[model samples]
Target: MTPEEAVTTRASRRSPRPRADAARNRDRIVAAARDVFVEHGTEAPLDEIAKRAGIGNATLYRHFADRRSLLRAVVLLIMCRVADHAERAAAETVDSLTALRRFVHDAVDERVGAVCGLLIDGGGQDSAEVAVQCRRVEATCETLMDRARHAGQIRADIGLRDLVISMSQLARPLPGIEYRDADAHRHLDLLLDGLRVPAPAACGAPGGAEERSVTYTEHAA
Candidate 1:
């Protein structure tokens, strides 16, 4: 064989075709980890994650060197996805308040908040990439919230911390009960009602049924 042809053949041998099965396995692992983390928090057993993915411990180790690594990957994945959704929500609608409401509703519906809730309780070491991803998500949320506030849709007393804490708290599952996105959404709708300005009462409306907007006092930071 010619020298150039021989070199090309060697390179091809070194770089075999992509392993479709391996790729599928990695995907399954990521998905399973996400679910396990949401259900059991980040401290969930790695072996359980493997079993859920239909893979062995050795395979799980091959893909993720340690639990911290796996947790970071899950955090990064969920953050990026939620950020993408936030970006799309921010741009898709002309009404800033509508966009914010839509984003929050959809986020709760998808249980994105629950993922973050687990991470907060996990207390795992966060890699720089994971931290950066987290900042990105926070910034996106800030933008959405600010826009809504500027549009007079959100109360002046609300802040990013309030939103995050509410999300995490609402996302958490009660003892002996599993987390349900529907339950979260229901509470979120009630919370949103509190955030919005109340409609003005009609002239000569019945007493005691008048809408009252919650008075929010901003505390010193």
Candidate 2:
């Protein structure tokens, strides 16, 4: 091939390369930001995320304009995953109570706790994008709560706001507290009992009697 033709061919090949690299860099930044933020909360430094991503700060800023921008991106990414989980839960479970229980169980993990902690710490002083993501999460939770209530899996008296608040509280990981999966399951079982209708009658015995019980115990943290 001629020199000029070779040069032209190389240039054409290189032209799309930077765009691909940029795309990859953006993905790396997002992934790294997610890991860092989840580990250190949203207050994690962008420089740390850049370093973890193996990219320069300038590149990170070029992709995400500011901390808030990066935070919003992370929040949206998490919310999208939550939405997918909700969809899957809805489809797979026949019982709304089971679905709600599964959803809460899935959310009580470290990753969800980190996200919830970040938002709670941020409080009312959040960026517009964060606010939007919050609203989306709220809306999704409301829909799930409504479905659960409609299916008689939740109390009619409990509002979506109350459920949302309860979810946030339950998502918190208490320090010095040894929480086991069985404890979580027990908590969920108690919550479900509170939503249950009157117990059904016993059968197959003449002296059968229903026993109503409510017990509360405190555990050390």
* Best candidate (score: lDDT): 1
Per-candidate TM-score against the hidden true structure: 0.75, 0.60
**Model 1: per-residue lDDT, tens digit, 1-221?**
99999999999999998599988888889889988987877778999999999999999999888876777677667766777778887787567765665667656544566565556654234567667767777888899889878878878789988887787677676769765665665565556666765424331233212232221111001
Task: Compose the digit string of candidate 2's lDDT tens values, residues 1-221.
Answer: 99999999999987755578898999899778877986666778889999999999999999988776676666656655665666666666456665665565555442454566555554223566556655665666667777877876567887766655565555554756776645654554455455544422432223222231221121111
Instruction: Report how far residue 48 has shifted in candidate 1, in Å.
Output: 2.4
lDDT of 2: 0.62
TM-score of structure candidate 2: 0.60
Q: Scored by CA lDDT, what does every candidate get? A: 0.70, 0.62
Pairs with backbone N, CA or C atoms under 3 Å apart (clashes), candidate 1: none
TM-score, cand. 1: 0.75
The ten-residue window of minimal lDDT in model 1 covers: 212-221
